[model samples]
Target: MTLSREFKVGLFIGCTAIIVVLALLYLAAGKGVFENLHAFTVSSKSGDGFTEGMPVVFSGFNIGKVQALELNEKGIVLIKIKIPDRHVKWIRSDSAFILYRPLIGSARIVVNTTNLNSPPLDEKKIPEVIIVNDINDAIARIEPALERVTQIADNVERLTSNLSDPKGDLHRILSNAGKITTNLASKKSLVEMVVSDEESVKALNDSLKKLKDITTNVDRILTKVDKMADKTDSEIYGKDGALPQVNVILKDIVGKLQKLDKTIDNINKISSDTSEGTKDLHILRSDIDDTLKTVEDAVKKLDAIIGLKKAPEFKVP
Candidate 1:
């Protein structure tokens, strides 16, 4: 059972072909050809710098590649990027895809994902965004910053010159600060330093002492005056003082006046009764004199009618 030489040659060639096929498949697998590929679309307003086969880079690593570009009726360029299934997690909902084409470098789609833990991007959503850079606009924005930087540099130069000058305000401030620090560290107190010597401080303390003594004397005098006022108030208002004695004297005078008024009324009544009794005695005395005269006349008539001689010589009264 020996094989032919042609058959052996054919067997060798067939085995070689099978090995080559297997190696090719292995190489393709290594390059992710057999791996699952996911697709997603992004839109751009202008497709000026966008091109197919552009590498999508994230954190300096290529995660995907741009597959196709199509311009729709709305003048938007729709870009489709293909990524291996394992790298799909890098495209988050919060991820940004920027079409950054530097003036001096090749154009690329730069993907930046701030939060890698966010939800995965929904591939079915349409009209995903891609930001493109404009060189003219960037330059326009940078011109003001350049001007501000120049102004800041000039201001720094001026500040440095001022700080370096000996006659400048900064130097004066630093010199004053040094002098103040030195004064503070010295044996002299701040008050002595500000007032220009210990002598002035001693004089101030002496004056303050004298003022304190004067205030104490005044307070003592005021206390004595207050005691005098209290004594005077007690003497005037006390129960046995001059005010109560004077009230007692006034009451005694009032009682004596009432007794004197009663004595005056009794004297007036006695004088009226004496006056009426004297008038009645005068009238009675006058009537007695008239009766004596009539008796004498009747005795002379009886002597004449009896013709009898009356004895003349004997005077019997």
Candidate 2:
């Protein structure tokens, strides 16, 4: 037990080193150093009750912790969380992070995983923080619902009272219905008469007889028209009918028209040549005068041969 001063100093140094290592191991164990962890960033508009080291809970189990909180230049509050690998698979791409503040409790960060089979959210993806309804907000939402419930209750109460009262509007309405039923029962014969009156039956019978006569006339007329159509078809389009004769006449007319067309074409060509040759008006007038004198001499000789006393002068127009 009698140790030297140097030995005592060495012992003290050894104990200090051992204590430091144990503390480091304990810290690492508490922070899950041996377990696989995924880090994700969550952004919020307001960081009212959020802080570093807040627990991220899923189904009442704490699976992660907020590692850091930072406010960037854009004034957004960013919360960085580290979730253990075992629970990280539960955080889906469509998972929502809700910060719920109860009426009489501290704010809790809740992770809601809607789709279990969805792809896991990437560790580097930053999700938007969704703030849940606080006590005041929930109360504000329920006010309209409460008012609707009150209106429904009031209506139920009025209906109950109206049903119980014998002299109420509902009672009057039922009484009128009963009266209508009684009146209808008493006038059953009159209603039947109105539905089937004697004069209406007579008129209906007469109309049926007239419709039968009209149908007969229409049948006769249709038969006559059918005969007439058959006769006309036989006369017009039957074999050895007028249509063949008309076709032959039409062919003959067409042949004459072709000959007339050729004659017109020849006449047009002759007129064109004559116009081109007689470009001088004086020569054309002299030729016309000589042809007219020859025609006059022929006419005079024909009149003497026919023993005509005098022949009238023929003028060419």
Candidate 3:
């Protein structure tokens, strides 16, 4: 019932080798070693956050891993990805890949298939690299713009501080405007007093009334003068007017004057003829005396016709 030492050591060694082999097989299977794998190369400019053995995910499922990375002849990075044959059909020729690198988390490669009906991606064909922007890269891109924004904020802060200072022009201008508004509001009662003054309104009304009275008086005077002018016109131009009587009387006076002038001329001619032809001077004197008396009577008749109380003294000359 005793075991040999050599056989015991050999048995121990064989059991140990078997356990190690089984463990290795189990690890390989767990890593998809037996699964049919297909590979395609992805070209990129540089390796930023990508590395070997990184999971390539499809629709949030880990379907493959990055197999290797190398630089090609053109200095571009070439990343080879290995996917299982069963999952290879999930990636089509029309598929898109996106690398998402967040600020606080690890980077991941995402694969999307646009058409399930299209042909699967060929292993021999080159894959497209998904360019992604990391947080540091995005921040670097906007650094200059952020600097300008910071300068603008500083200027605004200075302006705000100046506006709040009592010695500043902006503050003084606002204070002056507020004071003017207050002064105008305080003088509102004076404006109301001037507008509501009863004495000035009464004086204006009285002046208007006096002007109306003067106009009425002027109209009445004009009416009186018109009436007087009409009366004067009637007296001078009517059928029984004084102007017609004066005209007739003047005509009669002119005729009497003509007759008197003729009578005096005839007397003068008779006196001159008697003085030359009669030898007796007494008879010529008597004729001259009678003509003088006749002249005196004509003068008296003319005075009576003119309604004179006494005839003017009639001198022979």
Candidate 4:
């Protein structure tokens, strides 16, 4: 069954055409060529090295791809994305587009629309900026905090080392505490002595109570004494009191005693003089004796009137 050259060539061409058509259908299916596409454009300050054919993810699901990329005159990258019209409702004016690069993967363009109630995004709208999830940048932002933490760790290490040193104040305090504990452990008799002195403690408490009672009694006594002193002072030194009359009487007595002393002095001088006759001298001596008798009789009458017989000794010189 060998065929002619022309027939063989036609058959080969048909087979090749069928294979090419099948290949094209497979390629179209893989590219989602049958799906309805909605065209939109996004502008970003930085594309984060995004190129054409990058997958556009929504909620971790690959929903579309970047169809084209171009830079405008302002040097902003414009990305044209093709998403299925079935997902058009997920795009909103408030939606955020991010060009994120993980620590170990190529850069990606993600679309997030948390509030779908907002107005739908306009066609060919240019996005504000490109946001990248760069771990290096995050770490760079936390560098100062990390440095502060490192410094704090160093200070803690130094403090711990100082606390551990036997010569440090903390070590000394711990040593003193250990010594106190050891002393308490060794001196069981001290605890027993304190425990056995219950009577002394009670005695001390009783003494304190007695002292308080004595203080109270003393205060009452002091109050009574103050009242008595006040009464005595009022009675003694008040106007129209007996003490005032006594003081006046004593002053008058002092004056009278001074006059009597002058008289006695004059009489003594007269007695000492020898210019008179002896009979006149005898008469003068008799008058002096009579005057003394009269003074003694007057003093006796005064003593009887003032009830001096019941009084203590009355010294008259």
Provide the clashing-pair count of each candidate structure: 0, 0, 0, 1
Candidate 1 residues 58-92, lDDT tens each? Answer: 88888889999999899988999998887888998
Name the candidate, 2 or 3, with the larger lDDT value: 2
Q: For candidate 3, give the lDDT of residue 264.
A: 67
**lDDT (C-alpha, whole model) for all candidates:** 0.77, 0.78, 0.77, 0.76
User: Candidate 2 local accuracy as lDDT?
Assistant: 0.78
* Residue 248's lDDT in candidate 1: 58
**Highest TM-score against the true fold, candidate:** 3
The digit string of per-residue lDDT tens for model 2 on 1-317 reads 89999999999999999999999999988777778878899999888778787889999888898888899789999999889878888799999999877877767789999999999888778899998758769899899999999999999999999998999998999998897677667653554344446566668669999999999998988887777767667765677655565566557556655665665575566577886775555665565566556556655654453343223233322
For TM-score, candidate 1 versus 2, the one ahead is 1
lDDT of 3 by residue, 41-153 (tens): 87778877788888888988888988998889998888898898778888888888777677776677788898999998876777767867688787998899999999999
* CA deviation > 4 Å runs, candidate 1: 1-3, 103-105, 126-317
lDDT tens digits by residue: candidate 4, 259-287: 66776786676767656534456766776
lDDT of 4: 0.76
Scored against the true structure, residue 254 in model 3 reaches a CA lDDT of 71
TM-score for all predictions? Answer: 0.39, 0.35, 0.40, 0.37
Which residue window of length 10 is worst by lDDT in model 4? 308-317
Q: What is the clash tally of candidate 3?
A: 0
The segments of candidate 2 whose C-alpha lies over 4 angstroms from its true place after superposition are: 1-5, 33-37, 68-78, 84-86, 135-317
